[model samples]
Target: MHIPDGYLSPQTAGGLWALMVPVWYAAGYKVKKTLSARQAPLVAIAAAFSFVIMMFNLPLPGGTTGHAVGGTIIAIIIGPWAAVIAISVSLTIQALFFGDGGILALGANCFNIGFVLPVTGYYTYRLLSRGAAEDSPRRWFAAGIGAYVGLNLAALITAVEFGLQGDLFKAADGSALYSPYGLSTAIPAMMIPHMAVVGVIEAVMTSLIFVFLLRNNPSLLHSYDGIRAAATGRLQLKPLLIGMALLLVCVPLGLLATGSAWGEWGAEEIQADVGYVPQGMDRYLGRWSGILPDYAFPAAEEADTGEEPAGAVSLEGVKESVPGYMVSGVVGLALVGGLAWFSTRLLTRRSRKKEQLD
Candidate 1:
């Protein structure tokens, strides 16, 4: 689901940024208004959960793989506005540090996963679970259904983003300049796996977590059903910490899945597979390099011999080693978790100061 650099034209990427800036601002304002000191830790933990969950990629029927974003779950647990901040933070770290996503396409990526998925999923869950109690089976079922539908919608939007590039940007010979595949190819290639396997994973994950939280620590679910657990001055952090630890343990499962995503291929791989790389992709995709490109560190031998490292794995047509993937996951978790925690703490302090003045 991480659209690497060069997949989108400058216009498309810029357009997405323009669309998202105001959305991000509004989310920040809304979150600031509603966020309490007690809920600060919840936002951070939810962000960490979103960060780690995206690491577990599920293999699809085709040679490609996708992961559950956990956006909707975060939205349901926290508010959609807060989910926006959490997911955007995670995606920003992945793009800037790990190179999991394109730098230029960060706006598009955040818009898809951070904005579209959470907002849509949150609303869907609310609509379906409206009359039901938070602990009701119907509410859980609604969460599952909402997650499934929300993830697919995000996938569909991503497909359209890719498809539009083909029509809007092309070479003199009518060849695509950025993403080569039109809607006919992009939609099916991206949506099938989500509609089948990935969606189910997201649905199950959301429902199970919702149930677990509801049973053990209903206070953590303050965002749902307008419940104010903080009124008691006791916040349950143990369950969330335990869940985060478990997710860390399961991070390796992402490596077990083989094949790259449908449209995230590198320039060399795209050219070899399609006989020619799209001009825009070839030009802009490799423009920026991250500390760990493809989550792989070049071997010391490569520095000495000036040759490609032997530790490279060709899973996504990139030389990403297993150790590199593990390191990237750990580092990403720390950075994202730290940022979320720090930001929420600051927001809480400011909110407190404002209340004192009031």
Candidate 2:
């Protein structure tokens, strides 16, 4: 779930950043030490997958929409450290470029999806898959179960973040200054769809992908140096590239999703739904104008014709939104994949230099 701006107090967001900075640093160090040339491309591909997978939003029964983070699958395929970096990069791009998540809330979003999801999912997978053969059905079951649990846990953490804003911050009139929903409202609103639907999707995706890799290119799967590697041989990129191409073709499905996330509504939308917008939210929300708000280009023709504002494009049933989303997906994948690949190349060079010195 992407918490938009004005959903969390500055204190909450800042605190999450303080917590995440060290985690990010540690993960980077670990990745530098463990990532090999053969594994680097896998990380880049996984990063691209993480970037693109979020484009396929699924409408929930309750009128809202959700999507799998792909964090657990990445963690199972690579390692948790690399998963953290990949997801953090993807979330940052979504926030800074696409306005999918709040810029101020980037830390919280990364913590939830990047850190919490992967670490929890990876550990759960290890625990359940232990003592089982690499290609055994038990390993697949473990991946599914781990993904289900990990996604739900991330949802729970997100609910707590929203709930805390209500509990800890309020206006002079007792109106919530940040997120209006308390624990009672936030927990159910976030948990239901994630646990019942989103988690299932995550589980199935993780298991299926893991199974495919095991059958076709098991060597590409990171074993955490035998701790988690499923199969061993040489790295393969064809399957991953093919999977990404298929996902890119399906990016437009996200536009078909019905409603926004529970806590991601803008101030005006919140007012329309609840009859009163939180004063703090109304004042602070729209702090940043992204290059592509909601992955749609500004309808310049509509603006020139006085049909709508320059940046206003209806999210519902718009034929033009498809091309815009497709472009966003492809561009995001390229940026993230290139960054990951470059970073790994640098790391590989440094490692080689160190070995020479030794």
Which candidate number maximizes TM-score? 2
- Model 2 residue 220 CA deviation in Å: 2.4
Residues 225-267, model 2: lDDT tens digits:
5322422345657878998999999888777775677788877
Pairs of residues at least 3 apart in sequence or in different chains that clash in candidate 1: none
Clashing pairs in 2: 223-228, 223-229
Q: After superposition, how far is residue 65 of candidate 2 from its true place, in Å?
A: 0.3
Q: Tens-digit lDDT track for model 1 on 278-328?
A: 888888887765787655565621433334333333453333355676777
lDDT of each: 0.81, 0.82
Backbone N/Cα/C clashes per model: 0, 2
Indicate the residue-level lDDT of 259 in model 1.
63
